[model samples]
Target: MSVSVMAATAASTTVGTPWINITIFGAFVAITLVVVLRASRNNKTAADYYAAGRSFTGPQNGTAIAGDYLSAASFLGICGAIAINGYDGFLYSIGFLVAWLVALLLVAELMRNTGKFTMADVLSFRLKQGPVRVAAATTTLAVCFFYLLAQMAGAGGLVSLLLGINDKVGQSLVVAVVGAIMVLYVLVGGMKGTTWVQIIKAVLLIAGAFVMTIWVLAIHGFNFSTLLGAAAEAGGAAVLNPGLQYGLTDLSRLDFISLALALVLGTAGLPHVLMRFYTVPTAREARRSVVWAIWLIGLFYLFTLVLGYGAGALIGADRIKAAPGGVNSAAPLLAFELGGPVLLGIISAVAFATILAVVAGLTITAAASFSHDVYASVIKKGKAAPGSEVKVARITVVVIGIFAILGGIGVQGQNVAFLVALAFAVAASANLPTILYSLFWRRFSTRGALWSMYGGLGSAIILIAFSPVVSGTETSMIQGVDFHWFPLSNPGIISIPLGFLLGWLGTITSRTLENPAVAAEMEVRSLTGHGAEGATDH
Candidate 1:
């Protein structure tokens, strides 16, 4: 068949019924509600709500980490990428795994040792709380909102495609469902509930992907080479090699680099992920949790490669493009094709689980930052008791959920993968450098940390606003906004460095004013996890 005819034929295949999808999705929601309700009783204390009461063991924490990290971008986006873009898409898996290594080796233990709740807790180790809190909260809210937008967008796309709803309606529904479940989880179940939900989701996602991978290969005559050859023949050279779509050369290469930076550096900086470390009681447990998380992440990402390539070979690019919602539908669509109706139904349920699980995690994290960092620490000066803190967190979860739904409904047509990358760039730029320097750099002062956070945050936001994806500009948004200002789609290339530069300059300019006695106590607390109160210079 001619490629055009093959594409048309592939596009015309009927998917499963909308009612079937909605029924399955409804069941998933019921399960989450039950879990959240059961967990909420234990969430009375702020520690319980914000950090799961520091109760999870290493392995449980590891699973939750996997659940938290494996967002829609990993499941839907990567598979779609693989189906449409070929092996180049698998590169994301590599970048994510490499990033965890940094997390495990560098930040995990230190974060657990120093900070009580948010990234700001760590950066404010020696600084006056006022400037650090303001900067940290600004970065946290911005990062969470940007990241939530992508997840919300993904949830909308997933629901719309699977259930055949209008995109805006689908997004709104997704936002509401996710927001409700997460609010309950944080309000009732708190940290413990969120952790378990994450663990369960990780297991479901891995099992579902494994089942789909097997079916995909079986349909391809169980031959790996045949799969690649078929994918190549089907997609042409663009699919076979790392072509322009993979961003291997020139402009595309820059885009690729930006994505890599976001995935690698951004993981460590995310408030949600950092907060998970605090859930572990001790620094050693935190370290072990990350070690296991890296392995799980590696294994799951590996399966995505098969799912992506398998879809490419069996389902074809034309069909994926013509899918209800572009390439994001490739995995589910492929499931139906390979395993027929039963498998389609099962995979549809799994996809719903993926969305709910990811959204729950994101909402809880955002809530924690709002309540713990902004509300309790900055506004109340950490005066609230653990019980009151938990109550506040629950309320914030509901409020944040509403905002997420609104944002999700508003940006229904946006590319979630692109949004996720922007989140990463912002986190890496605004949060990571400050935390790292504060922990290890003795010369770093309050002024230095404050300046770094502001500089990084400003650069990332400005760069992203002008980015092609957000600005709707025809120019390579990074390249077109005047090369003199920003040169990459992701701002880590510029913003991260700028953060460090500002911090260094701020410290040097104010070296005489630096307080030695306060610095020593901050160092001890940050490195030892000894003092939760009275370390504040605020």
Candidate 2:
């Protein structure tokens, strides 16, 4: 009754056509459109557009945060990795789950109490608004750009595979449709619509995973050891070990550590994730939301472990490798093999919803950075009309969505999980240091914040551009060219230290002028929520 035994017995069964998947996916799209239309009715002010008027209860915001954090990269990419690399793929899940501890303990309440709408609000609270806002906005866009590239590429591949379209034109069309829908979500529903979408997706995603895991276990007579043993047999003995994919040699070990560092530290710096804290009504609510998010996210990842190992056990690595996107198609194929067309269609729809919800969240955060942080705070000196700011945010969403479509089409076939790791590296290098110093160091100055943001941002981009991922490897975009100069694909180890060093250098070398009064006020507000944004119902 093990999945492998079942797969062997049922190998000759005919699978259903792509039209079933299309029908399910279309239904999801229709539901999302209705959600956005309903949410748009209340998006009249800046607060409503950017922070959902700070009215979400703790549990609601927590589910939204889970939806935002568990992107296509997490649901599909991580599962794919596990199907291919076995135990090594589970390492990414562990890193991601552990990072939430940092967010829950250090950042959740602090960010909620100090910031109004964006990460810039917290960083610029005790620093110079103009320079700090500019630097923070720059980093936010940078993180979102790389993150969107990965999600959109995954979106295109998923759409193409599920719809049985094998051509580049078909993939491009899928990206366009996804981009347009994401734009609609942000421009019309704003945070309220996006949050609801995320909540619904999170529920569906978790429920889907739970059902799949139970089905997998039932096939194995509810024996965990039987499942693990079968997976090892299908994937070979190396699949159960650490060095199969990421941790082979000295250099690879260093790279693995660097990737772990980025994943652990980067969550705290992610602007979209940080912005979720502001949607709740109070600092206490924000704290509770993080706890709720931690539980939900942890449960989902546990289910992912079962899905991954079961896929490897049931689908076989050779067959998974021969699929369209190789291991990326493992989970979908497993669903087909297990429950035929119906479960496959459901899983495909969930994957599509995952991409849409994540991209919408990223779009809103990037738009908020441009409008709330840069336009309203920097260009207008905080005097921009609320209506005008919201209008600018809507326009920015369209622009960002268009750019993401082009980028996704351009980077098709790339490993989405790798690209996501790069995005995390940039966030860790550029944003985390600035956030930590801005919150903790009394001597942290505007000059330090700027150097931390720019230095980290510059180093991450430069290193990634020269790394083997771009050109040296067979899996790279331009595989024939070998112009890679950077040894490690992830730049976290070097760039993170450099960010801290530059911040210290800038602070000590610059003028000794310090704003003790503002620091004191920020500290008081962050701890007590005395002057933080209030709930809309209040």
Candidate 3:
């Protein structure tokens, strides 16, 4: 039988038999709950609640970072993109991998050496605390909320597809349940619980991807060239090169560049990813963890190529499109075709765990931003007790979780990768410039940081709201609406530069004198780690 006919037949047969998948998913959830419960026992102090007591080793922290960073976008969305768009889809993988270089070299050590609980801590170190904290907290919340929504949406779609719950209400219920669980992970387990969940999920995800890659390679006689040839024949010769999905014209090329810039810089600015640095004991460990993460992430992206091409070669693009959730279903369907119901169940369970882990991380970071940065520093004037701060963080977790559930339900039919890309754009545009200037530049005042954060954030939101992503296109989130005036969907190319320029302009225009003592102190501590926070034991 031909690939398309075979995939169609398989789909027809697999519609109602989701018992194995449900059981596997149940098992994963149970294990996660147990891990969280145990981790909660150690999360008594604010330090423990926020940074896992700074106990994770470099390798362990690296694995957890991988889990936190590799959302459904990396596992399901990227695979789907490659399965559908061929070589064009793999571009995202490259961009994501290259992003680690920026994190490793530019941000990781400085973040570890300087920050306490949130990215706001780092940015507000040498600058005035109140305004900078508020700005950082706002940007942090924005990035976390958008990223959380994408993960939650992916969870709902995966649940509906894998468990055969097709109704919109059913999917929304699933999203709510996932959101509730994520809240519990942060509220009870805190950073320690979330980190453990991420570590376990990372292991399972990497193992699942490795198995699938090995299976696909074996089927193709261990010859990558043969596999690519098959994918080319299945998806057409265009599948072997770029421009099938992007980079077709001057405007499209600009859009692609915007996307690449966002992905490359966003990792360094993500609040959740930055929070991971504090989970390690020393700046050296932070550096080592990034190295480990780079290796693991790079390997996983390589395996995604196998999974994507295998899906195209074996299942064909048409069936993948016709599948529920479109390209998002590519990895799961490929799992089913290659390894039967058992493997499908395993992969589906892992994907679900992926969503849960990412959501948990995002929630904690959002909570930390709210409680530590906003509530404690801004509202309470930094007089809030550690225990009270932890309580506030728990409350914030519930609030953020509720919002994420609602947002996820609202964005159910959208593309996971596209949503994630928008989150990246926001992070790159709003957070990256502020972080860079605060860390490196002596004249980076509170005004400059605020302008960078608010300018980049406002520009991104306004552009996206008026861009083709909102309307004026068939793939837009809002159809039958043509109010869009901006041409490009991704706003990083314009917004990122605007952020940096606004920072510069604000600094030169402001009369705020550069504090030489504060600058020297921050420089000395950031480079030598002389006054960094110490790790606490349970």
Question: Which is superior by lDDT, 1 or 2?
Answer: 2
Instruction: Name the weakest run of 10 consecutive residues (lDDT summed) in model 1.
Output: 475-484
TM-score of each: 0.91, 0.95, 0.96
Model 1 misplaced stretches (Cα beyond 4 Å):
1-14, 166-185, 246-249, 385-387, 473-488, 511-513, 521-538
Instruction: Please give the CA lDDT of all the candidate structures.
Output: 0.74, 0.86, 0.87
Ranking by TM-score: 3, 2, 1
Candidate 3 structure lDDT: 0.87
For residues 90-145, write the lDDT of model 2, one tens digit per residue.
98899999999999888899999989899999999888888889999999999999
Q: Which one is best on TM-score?
A: 3
Stretches off by above 4 angstroms in model 3 are: 1-16, 534-538
TM-score of 1: 0.91
Tell me how far the alpha carbon of residue 190 in candidate 3 is from the true structure, in angstroms, after superposition.
0.6
Task: Return the top candidate by lDDT.
Answer: 3
